[model samples]
Target: MPEVLFPLDSSKPFTDQEKIGHNRWHPDIPPVATIKPGTTFRADCREWFDGAINNDDSADDIRDAPLNKVHALAGPFAVEGAEPGDLLIVDIVDLGPIPQEEGSLAGQGWGYTGIFAQNNGGGFLTEQFPDAYKAVWDFQGSECTSRHIPHVKFTGIHHPGLMGTAPSAELLKKWNKREGDLIATDPHRVPALALPPEPDGAILGSLSGAEFDRVASEAARTAPPRENGGNQDIKNLTKGSRVFYPVFVPGGHLSVGDLHFSQGDGEITFCGAIEMGGYIDLHVDIIKGGMEKYGVSENAIFMPGRGGPVYSEWLAFSGTSVTLEGEQRYLDSQLAYQRAILHAIDYLTKFGYTPEQAYLLLGAAPIEGRFSGVVDIPNSCATVYLPTEIFDFDIRPGADGPTQIDPGMGAPRSANPNL
Candidate 1:
């Protein structure tokens, strides 16, 4: 079927705390038609700034811009028929990064805070590796110099800052009642969901327990309106990935914000190619039977070769193991891995695969089984992998017969002696 386009505009500026509730923003160009299981729609997205930052802005200008205006989303597109129990499957068809026009002073480039800070301030490395850094580059010139050092090569790519479905009203309300005040009114309440500490005490969205506790504690102290609830700045998702979200209400209230030019895994410096303003094209579909019973209720599915959804896969396996382990060493890393394998077996058996077949596949297929953090106390590990390529093969459905024979016996017997 032909793809439809949906354009959305935000009604008001959304904070990291207020974005949790539903229908916060209105759709500018409503869906020309309803989207179903097979229906596909192309969503056009504007930059996080919503066109605020421009090429003419300087490093000082960027550093001085208001935090509230940083990452703006394009829409609250309605997925017709989407309900609490349904799944919204989004296929990233294509992404077009905003190009840096020639001769434009817009510091259009890709880098995290470290790269930018190093460029502006000649810190530790400037004295020792005097020739390693450069503040600016001449795009047209074939050669460029950085403090007498010569270099070449420049390409810019922008990625989404934040992209996720709206949380349920109940979940949002609970979160607000628990952590709203700290995020809204208390400057000391900035929790560390993913960022690091800046000189200003707490950097919003940082990933730290202390920061998170302060934010949560503050939220409990004073109840603020639903802010950007369920909002986080994850820059790992790029082109060629699929993000599947669970529908919490009819029409699956969907929204996206935060745009980056590029970022590394883990987003170490807490900031990335922080350039704003760009276009994105997203395809929407419905996933059949994609939700779990409880615990964080969102199912994000990435396509083949794209590892963006690794977190979701790990969570699924971890949750299963947690339930199975009960009080028996559930906190142990090695034990958890073993239990996870058992969980996988149980899952496969439910799909009609024999225990033996499940075991074979678990060992042979792309199922990831590994020990990651054994050095730290209460070591933790995981073994789980999803093979997107398996669907492309056309192999026979049943198990093979025994391949060995008993020399003492007259002839070989089937492994399944019952047969």
Candidate 2:
């Protein structure tokens, strides 16, 4: 257990005190608490749904989680001695899910994974994955166990899905304008799905039923990361990772939420690996004029190692395409990489990775990528390798999965050369 920094009891659940929490990330929101540099604290946290979806939820129940009411954040816990232009260093100490059993809604001890419907039009592969789906996970110390999401049987790496300091007024204005421009460009707002503010903390960011006088929106969104660092679902930011954020506001109104029991790099599915409620043990420090020293603006993170890397052998998949050469083929990598990843993701689903689960697996698990062949005429090749040793159970190519020669693929595409 981490040392609690708030006036509240450590034994209490974070969801139990909604008033102390926050959904918006604006600098205007009142700070919950303030601490100087080198301050360490234990923060109890919640899932993206803010406790709505839970274990035993049907696929429908999970998919229905309001998209507008996205990631419910915790704390604008102000850093006392921090200021703008400086860098805020958050050293992640530890993380674990809430362990609750036998309840209409149980969390902390376990978490759930979900894929929304295409009607909502969310997620990276929303078109291919048109239906709603759900899977539950039970998290013990250091690992997550789930029979629901098949194929993976490794101990999980627990990390917060969203963590960062508050955005300044300038940044908020810029976000609104950019999002507005994007919305104007396309009404659907495909990939540039900017979160506009909505009434009610998105799920209330306050203490024990108390409401903050604000709306939850893009600035508060636990989605795209900014200089202040909101939601950059990097799976490697686990215990011992040193995260650096460029301070934008005074006291660096720091907030954290969107805890993931586990996740992969791409977070391809909008939902993510295993959405769970957990606790964060963080050590906060301020680096004077550090942002200036870095020679660039915006927030960035430095990870020493995620739960320490485990060396292992891998099963690799190759992707072939036209022209790895020249600027005209910049889009080739996108097509090639997408094909390779899809191949890998589809292959994993056979052994328990749901389309969504498999997407998450490709991200969270230690996979490597390489450019295999560039000399094959006008073709370039890439490969994404999955470590075979990561799976605790013996993982043979299951019946459900398509082998290397999946239909429409595997055959050399040398006819049109660019095909």
Candidate 3:
């Protein structure tokens, strides 16, 4: 059995505030616990929102939830045998559905999938889906059922979207300077935030009270993937994978967060996949000079495809765009690709698709996307592939909104009186 360092008491409801882990990735935040290498431990990770998000939440909830508080990580668990110049091999032993009895969420058995509907500044696809949306999923270990959406059902994978070790003070400083240069490239960017004086009450596990005794610079923001590997968002990092990332800090203070039940390739409509808090089993080891051997400047990870769904067949759409003079711009390529998704949305609407239906279809379907290439100079192209087998009926959209979907679509939901 794995060592229960940060154990979530399965006996009670998982709503307790005291048991949650720290959120920030700053070296100064200090380690919550320490362990020797080759040891496996269960990390009780908080949701990306900490614990504030809910089934009843609105788009305003997402837009208003704590912008800077982003991913509520579990721990900076200092591996005893790890040190600088070594590679921290984090073995993803297992992730979970966050047993309904002890998980953070109240509604779904395990998780929630959603889209950010901020009217102002939001995701890359915010303009298209300009409303708050969510679909709570009731997970049964491997398969998940949803009441909010009924047109689909698929097996869920326990994938931890974010995991990484900490960076040294020197490496942290270097990372900040380089990213700052990139931000400087865009003159309109505002001054960076060190540690926000306070985290909005909506998110749990945030740095507050004595936790702010030392605040690392804005460089410690948990979003970017740096040398120490914070948030890579690699979907295939499920079970049985060995992550080989450079260790910059002493003890390789490793942290893990942003636990996802399941997610598609391009989380096109952001906010997240089956967002839930649960236990994670990790077998961590340290490799000396592994970075030099692998020759990875950025963090390198290997994910096995065994534990999740893989693409077999897809109905794909391609987007092509070019300037009048034949010069291809990437922004146009992106726009065209997104437009093709909208086209798929329009096409599926004939079979009765709501905005949420279209969104969930994109999520549940095995959609594959690629920038393809920009080699033509004048024309660049991108492709969005949709799994044709997912739609059992003929190719047409209709009025099958949430309330009208076929009962055969998914497992029975105890919620949703409208159905």
Query: For residue 9, what is the lDDT in candidate 1?
Result: 31
Regions of model 1 farther than 4 Å from truth: 1-37, 51-58, 99-158, 181-236, 293-301, 304-375, 378-419
CA-lDDT, candidates in order: 0.38, 0.64, 0.62
User: Residue-wise lDDT of candidate 3 within 1-419, one digit each (tens)?
Assistant: 68767755444432354455555455655676789888888887667765566665343455445656667677778888676778888888887755546444622366776665544223435656655566667676676667666555666656777888776777766776776677667645322322232333212233455445435233356765666677766667888877887777787778787887776656666654667777789988888877777776456666564677654667666767743345556556776666566666666655556656577556544467678865766556777777654444534334653233453332212222111
Any runs in candidate 3 off by more than 4 Å, and if so which? 9-20, 57-60, 100-108, 119-121, 181-213, 216-219, 321-337, 364-366, 392-419
lDDT of 3: 0.62
lDDT tens readout by residue for model 2, 312-337:
66788876663224234533654465
RMSD of each: 19.4, 7.6, 5.9
lDDT tens digits, residues 210-327, model 1? Answer: 6444443322111011222223434435666676677665677565545554332222222323333334666777654456533225445444325322322221353222434255
Order the candidates by lDDT, highest first — what do you get?
2, 3, 1
Name the candidate, 1 or 3, with the larger TM-score value: 3
Ranking according to TM-score, highest score first? 3, 2, 1
| Candidate 2 deviant stretches above 4 angstroms | 6-19, 99-107, 189-192, 200-220, 306-311, 320-329, 332-335, 349-383, 390-419
TM per model? Answer: 0.47, 0.80, 0.80
